[model samples]
Target chain A: MSVTSASPSHDRPHWLALDRLGVLITLILLSSFLLPFALFRANRILLGDGLPLLASMQPVAASVLLLALAFGVGAALLRLPALIKLAAGFGVLTILFIAMGLSAETLMPADNNYARVSPAAGFWVLVFGLALLVTDALTRLRLGPWTRIGILLGVCGAFWALLWSGLWNELSILKEYANRAPAFWNEARTHLLLAFGSVAIAAIVGIPLGILCYRVRPVRAALLNILNIVQTIPSIALFGLLIAPLAWVAANVPGAKASGISGIGVAPAVVALFAYSLLPIVSNTVVGLLGVSAPAVDAARGMGMTWLQRLVQVELPLAFPVILTGIRIVLVQNIGLTTIAALIGGGGFGVFVFQGIGQTAMDLVLLGAVPTVVLAFAAAVVLDAFVELTSRGGRRA
Target chain B: MKPGLLLRVFALALLIVLLVAPQAFRDFFALFVRPTQPPIYTQGNLLDITLSHLMIVAIAIGLSTMVAVSLAILVTRPFGAEFLPLSRAIANVGQTFPPVAVLALAVPMLGFGTAPTLVALFLYGLLPIFENTLTGLTTLPEDVMEASRGVGMTGWQRLTQVELPLALPIILAGIRLSTVIALATATIGSTVAARTLGEVIIAGLTTGNTAFVLQGGLIVGVLAVLIYDSLSALEKWLARRTGRLTRADA
Candidate 1:
């Protein structure tokens, strides 16, 4: 804490005050949207029955009250140790989750199992506020990457426990889940395959393209222009364009359909995802290879290494980090883009989102959207770690 | 003044004429391209739809540039330096959230229209501009910054007159990327009834009309390339202008 706080007087330490934190908490408390949050039928969120805050949810009110008081005190102190701030942020998140669980239990009349409660726009704003608070505190903590990963694992474990223990059985999103629990895994599997398959294909195609761009100057401009043009074609249109050609191939060719190359479904989804993944991967590959120093290559040649040996033993290792960075972008991006697969019956978490929108079910949308985000984030984190590990190995060598 | 710039101008003018009078394309499209299927997307005024699309993209990019550039400036400042990681995490979240998911979630609240699309586009646009701003400010030449300080310029003056002008090219590059991306993504807005070019594309998809899909795709693709080229020129013009200033100073 002193490390950060001990700024030179001339540098001007930015003050952390009670009123600033109070404003966030106050807004959460005072907002009308939070005051009369929605109570929905088990089936839908669009048809909301408003429930007044203090009257309908005593536990939630108390929790928020206690959180505000604690935050107010912390803010009044002006500065605190990093660990303490992190703990406070964690406590705020804990209170939010517990309040959500408690509201699920107490708010709905026990007699009617079909009744559900959905947090209103104000509740979402409060969630956003708490997230900002937590992010600020976590940055203050300055935890190492491994420790951050550990914290994420802990959070995930706790969340899983909450779900498995059925404490959130009454939550509207979980109700949506209860109906499609079996199919959810299938969709998840499809989403993963589509994302990863595209990455694999893109790396196979794009790395060579990048290398070609590096080696052949004349090929670079035309190839890049084509890829750029392809990149700008919106995914929806790209998907639509693929339909006709793919349908023709599937209809005319003897074995195309059997090979999963149909107009609609996983085939076209994977193709579109592959196209989207190419630009980043190819560009990165070019940048990484071009970035390798001439001296390093010369040294390898002087050592009597063959061109292949020089590339494998020197250039590739040096280029690995940048290449990995490109792969990371493509991987994360493909995870998000694969959600569109469900639009064409390719099947992913987007099925839930589109269906939910059709039914005006917010929880179902969350059910799909939340996992897709988590998957993308997790893929990014893992890829980043892998890149770091590989680069560290290169440095050691 | 460059031939490339002149060509871009001519191309843009032609595009405007085509969008405003797509009947201009209809006869030409029929003559040059073999329409495998009849285009059913000719009913709506393509100009109005294109303008609406551009308007939505403009609003989203404008809002994002303001917020993202401000946040970038803030986090790069001495007082707000610690918030850098938090800002990055927020931007990453914005990127990671699928626009479709945002649209689906927002439709219930905002109804089926541009509101949800705007929200999605704004969120999607944030990361590129934010990252670019951060890179531009942080990567300013250290000696140049010291020279500004040694010359006794205040922080605000140094930032506005020196740092920002030097960083303008990179920042513009980010904005260019964001704009192009937003233009492409805005087509999806039609799915939620935001009255976009994506309507034509979606209509084609549902009816399997290849001609309609081609028409929509061609317009959007051409628009992206033209905007991209124009922005690149602007970036180059800024760089050349700054280059002259630096040379004069030397």
Candidate 2:
């Protein structure tokens, strides 16, 4: 198929192309048409009955979505330019988001506080499919790093505007948010604190340890083995294991309790996260430093630069990108681990997740889960760009 | 005789003792629990919970391997080459989504218990296997591939006999990674009411039973390390067998 496509065949019919994008678009259409678009519940916690696309919203809104779907299918099948294909993908997505909100508004009985509406399987599948299409188009276009970040910001801003405009107020997740807005922000803060605070501390401790490991062969092997073993422990188990020791400290150790040190909360959570974080940072540092070119180091030595000077001015600078990559990994991993921190009363997004699970409130769970995902995804992208930029700059230097 | 084999045997022995006879370790665990509280997790047998946990990980890893390996193969093939970028993007992005969050999200659609947990583990495990398999298959030596073709091997024959065998070590590394991850993640399945070793940890957490938590954590940690080591050894062996690893590599 690629051979055929690569061949000089401009005269070939466009519809016969049937590229991979077409297959995804077809799946999007099939799912949107066949599966439930929205689910309507009597209350926040009850299981909702599925609603088809047409039945999910007003006729006009449904038709508008259908039109966008048709356009998406057209974009997929036709030999459109990459930019146009991208626009069609985004157009479908934007319409889908709006229609989801509209569906919730339509499905909810006016003045019925108990009524709840949420996006069902079909809605998620569409979002996923369209997102893939948009991504594929972007890849084909070969957008630069900054432009990709700008697009990310744009998409984020669009979602923010949608949220701010009260478009999705009737959606179950939004409704869950409205009730616990303050708590939501509070948990978000704690979540960020757990994830970022640990990474910050780990970097401070890990870099030097990594340097030491790089310098000392026996220590390198022993330290890495220990960290590897630590890494294998499940986050929950680690969190659980920390409880007793920290509690002991809080109780028996002077000023520990007063200093906010405890077994089950932020202290243990941060400690566990920090422990989990060290392996990546330390290993990355070692790798990055080792990766510094031998010629460069010899040149630095020839120039009469001291050992520390060579490390700071030569090796560290060269290794900065790989180190940043490690930091990126740790940051993302910590963010996810922070969710599990909620189990131990560390107070993060997982608070809502566990509470929702306990109460059987799916939307409440989403309130916790969605932001965690979005945050991890954003961090990954931003840090990936940083890594790429630095590596490129390193090459030039 | 080898250190890797010795470590594996030790871990396996310890794991079996812990699972089959909690009474043997009761005194040790009692140090952690208060005098009034039970040291052992008495709600379910340790062996049963461990078995179920292994079952969940096995099932999830098995399903994910099939799906991810197939997808990797598809995208690498000539007919499905167009999907390479898209599949890569999906795998990369999917991994950034946390396992715990994925498990929670699965609950809304699949409801409580093993089903949601299975779905979450399956999704969570896909990236490592897919990415590794993709790397392995694509990075095979060009000469070897040409040689296979030179021998008049059909596409299917080349893939099955030549490509897969040469790529087995790297692919095994991916599955090993996926399996290790699934083991850890499956413990979280208890939060969604799935039967797994997390039950012990959760029970301990809720009831303030440090012994139970330690018991669960110890078992999980031990199991993870053992499996990781064993798989790594297998990967190395495969690499050696395939001549991918020379004496210098060893």
Candidate 3:
């Protein structure tokens, strides 16, 4: 599936235009804060005073121009591969500012004031629109990495801007994302801290647990069955189960909250994410350990090594990669599932999503989703790198 | 081999205690609380959650298999390869957009019920189905088709009789994956105003009642794993029946 494998070099020669994508990303990022200013002024100029500015705020002309610019950017990103991505990015961001300028002037009165034209909101809507369209065209056109990066950044920037400003604060829709924001970080801190702690705990618990399962048949069967059962429960339920007992301890025990026995906020989220992590780590570790050849383990014993010594020296080293692979899957899945904690008052990006739904603001929803997606993907990529490193070490061993 | 039996038994005991403990909290609620007519716990409603999940899984798998097989067959012809990358990219984009987002985006277009649920389920199920179909079909022995043609079978006949039969085991694996994913994904249906197991869990979150959520979540999770395991066993059985067990070593 490698693109450069079969196609003629000349056909994909335009893949070189990717450098401009960086410029596009930078401009879009910088302009997100500036664009709102443009809208504020446009309304002031069109409705308040200034005939000259009102002419500039003309919506019909701007609408036509924005549509033309979007198509032009689409074509540039699609056709040129790397060539016009940066240029197109700037144009797209500029078109967004101009479009907003026209819309605000045409739609709103002069009294409303907000600072800096939001380049970021444009990133989500028009920017992602172009990116999604281009994602299809990129393959047909055989564009390479650079051009795609521009589109990614532009989309990300927009989502970030809207989210930061709480743009989707509307009550009727996208409300789910907004309601949870006040406790958002406390929820994030609870879960994020738990995720950090749980992964560490999982490696401790899951690896040894996996080894136990590998060494003992009945034990492995029992644990695997339990882990499998736990894994199947949707993440929401997992957090719910973890929360009840912890809440009991908080209320009943006289000084439990002060002593940190309260179950509600972060603890349950951690436990849920942790339980979710257990199956993969344990199963993988067990598989990896059992996968070590019997002859090799016997050979280590034959060299006058005791059981523990053999495990430390030969078996464990050989089993590390498979175990690591399990950990990788567990961590990645955990991050993705953790987003739902917002529902449980455990809060992460789920707040924004739920808030957006309640508030009816699509932009705020994207703010949560974009980061969660990036977080999940980043976790996956980082895990892959670790797996690659450990796997390489495993190979050498 | 059974070293952890006692530990596991103890752990299960703890799980039972933890799972059932919320009832004690409910009893406490009755002791010192204002009288509200809403029941704190109900067993029959949990059963309803299970039935709804079954329906979602059934519809999702049925529709997805049809679409996936059709797309898979379409891609086999010479012209299909040109669209293979495109199809896969579409599947990727579809998956990359969270199921929750799919639920959100689909609601306006499809209205607020089972229709949106099915769309989300179908789109969510597509990647696994398509990938498996592609893998199964492409991996078939090239000579199988030649021999069918050598015997003068038409292209359609070759596909249905020879190619598909040969590809059944791998294709079934994809079906298995789709089923598990669909089963779990049905939980999201609750948020979209569709009645499913997720309603139980979401209600638990909103009302701070862990028992209701646990009831639904536990059942849904167990069902998915069991179905996956059952299909896995069936896949192996099919492989043996088809002489793949013996042929694999060779």
- Which has the better DockQ: candidate 2, or candidate 3? 2
Q: Please tell me what DockQ candidate 2 reaches.
A: 0.82
What is the C-alpha lDDT profile of model 1 across B1-250, one tens digit per residue? Answer: 5886787788788888777767666765554234665543576878888888889999999999998899899999997776687787777667766777777777767877889999888878888889988988888888899999999999999989998888787778888888988898888788778888998888887776776777788789889988887787778888798762221111
- State candidate 1's TM-score: 0.89
* Residue runs of model 3 more than 4 Å from their true location after superposition: A1-110, A113-191, A249-259, A290-321, A359-364, A385-397, B1-50, B85-98, B104-111, B141-154, B204-211, B245-250
TM-score of each: 0.89, 0.96, 0.69
- In candidate 3, position A92 carries an lDDT of 60
How do the candidates score on chain B by TM-score?
A: 0.87, 0.95, 0.79
Sort by TM-score, best first.
Answer: 2, 1, 3
Q: Name the better of 1 and 2 by TM-score.
A: 2
Best by DockQ: 2
Residue A275 in model 2: lDDT: 98
| Model 2: per-residue Cα lDDT over A1-397, one tens digit each | 0112233446477534766667767776776668899999999887779989998899999999988888888787766566777899998999999999999988899899888999999998888778877887777777766877888899999999999999999999999999999999999999999999999999999999999999999999899989999998888889989999999999999999999999889999999999999999999999999999999999999999999999999999999999999999999988888999999999999999999999999999999999999999999989988898899899998
Candidates in order have lDDT scores of 0.76, 0.89, 0.63
How far residue A36's Cα lies from its native spot in candidate 1, in Å, is 4.7
lDDT of 3 by residue, A1-397 (tens): 1243223336665543432333343344444333332222232112222122223347565557556554554444333432244345455655654454444335444444421122223334455544533444445546333445445556568656754654333211233334455665555565466656778888888887877787788998788877877767777777777776888788888988887755566678777888889888888887788788899988997899988898889988898888888877776666666667777676676766677556545445555665566765555545655666677777776
The iRMS of the candidates, in order, is: 2.0, 0.9, 4.8
- Over A74-120, each residue of candidate 1 has an lDDT whose tens digit, in order, gives 54244555455556656666666666666667767777756777666
Report the candidate with higher DockQ, 1 versus 3.
Answer: 1
lDDT-based ranking, best first? Answer: 2, 1, 3
